[model samples]
Target: MKGKNIFQEKETHKYDDIIHLPHHVSTKHPQMALSDRAAQFSPFAALTGHEDSIRETARRTEAFLELDEDKKEQLDEKMHVLQEYFSEKPEIMVTYFVPDEKKAGGAYVTHRGRIRKIDTYLRRLLFEDGTEVHMQYIFEMDGEIFGDTE
Candidate 1:
């Protein structure tokens, strides 16, 4: 798996054939093993996985679909290179792949972000906690940046 989503809350199919007891009989309880797997993966269930992170990137902005699916991949590939400069190198741009109701057309939707202000090449950002809000992650639903001009 390129990226495993073991953090998701989903059904687990873990099972063990047999378990030997000290002096009595052997056990073939499948539920116990299944529950064990569930517990093992539970710690990260609430944490963000790949898809979650992608969506989180969109929730922050409304212009996630400026590129088509094919183009989005191209953009994502380029954005991945571009993301290398931002702190955490987050995939925050592609989050807006889905079309929202406010948009008239489901075509390309680009949020105007001033690339000059971003220092993604350095993998650092001006944001305090390292949230590299990009054009795609802009706050405005109309694809506008909303924050300090600087």
Candidate 2:
């Protein structure tokens, strides 16, 4: 009585006759499992994959970079020097842009590995580990072998 409000007292009076009654068990249908009953009251996703779509849209990506003439010339010179030292299989670091498979923009990745061979037909820099970087996507190349070329 001390903790109960007047409204609560009136509400309890209305259900006094049935307050101690046993809960009804359906005779027409079998009882549901506790897990299944709990699942009915559990939180659910009405929009399904909408949250994933929103997260994917909110994700950031980098735009592909276009090198200017001066930079392009420098890169071309580096490529020439790399070819000269190709037979030596020099270890090098290459910075390149990788396009996102599901989006317009991409990301710049720097890879360090030993050069395997340059595929002229494919126009890609192949690595000893079977990694390939397309020539057009290359941003920069660096190595001890290109010290004099730079």
Candidate 3:
């Protein structure tokens, strides 16, 4: 004997006849591929290169250190020792500063190689594999080859 609400009753089917009808076909353009259709809804970047710019800004680099006269003298003496042992193909570790291409600061890198040639004309120390380190940028050099060559 409970009364039913007017809105709660199921609505009569009005368009049930055409509801199952085939979708209308277009005569003008061919159907788009499923992948292409899905791509239309994919996320898009309105600001081009924004992410790259932010990443470049966030990139960090080290500052180059200035060597004092005493340190410079020590480096010079080491270079002299290395030059004497150059013919022996001495294995050494050379630490040098490399300037950043895009930032104010640079970085220090250590290279391990056998000395091939010291090009005073180019002011660079050449390695066996053609790697060259500028004399002005060299911070330190260490090896057993420089031990007894006083």
Please count the clashing residue pairs in each candidate, in the order shown: 6, 0, 0
Ranked by lDDT, the better of candidates 1 and 3 is 3
Better of 2 and 3 by lDDT: 2
True-vs-predicted CA distance for residue 122, candidate 2, Å? 0.7
- Ranking of predictions according to TM-score: 3, 2, 1
Query: Which residue segments of model 2 deviate by more than 4 Å?
Result: 1-31
TM-score of each: 0.20, 0.78, 0.81
- Which lDDT tens digits does candidate 1 get at residues 1-150? 556566442324232223343445457753457778788877565555988667755654333434457654554455444444444433222223334454333333333232333555663323334434344432222212211111
Clashing pairs in 3: none
The lDDT per prediction is 0.41, 0.93, 0.88
Where model 3 places Cα greater than 4 Å from the true spot, the runs are: 1-18, 148-150
Query: Model 3, range 6-115, lDDT digits (tens) per residue?
Result: 55554445567788999987899899999999999999999999999999899999988999998998888888888877788999999999989998988899999998
lDDT of 3: 0.88
Q: Please name the candidate that would achieve the greatest TM-score relative to the true structure.
A: 3
Best by lDDT: 2
Please identify which of the two predictions, 1 or 3, would achieve the higher TM-score against the true structure: 3
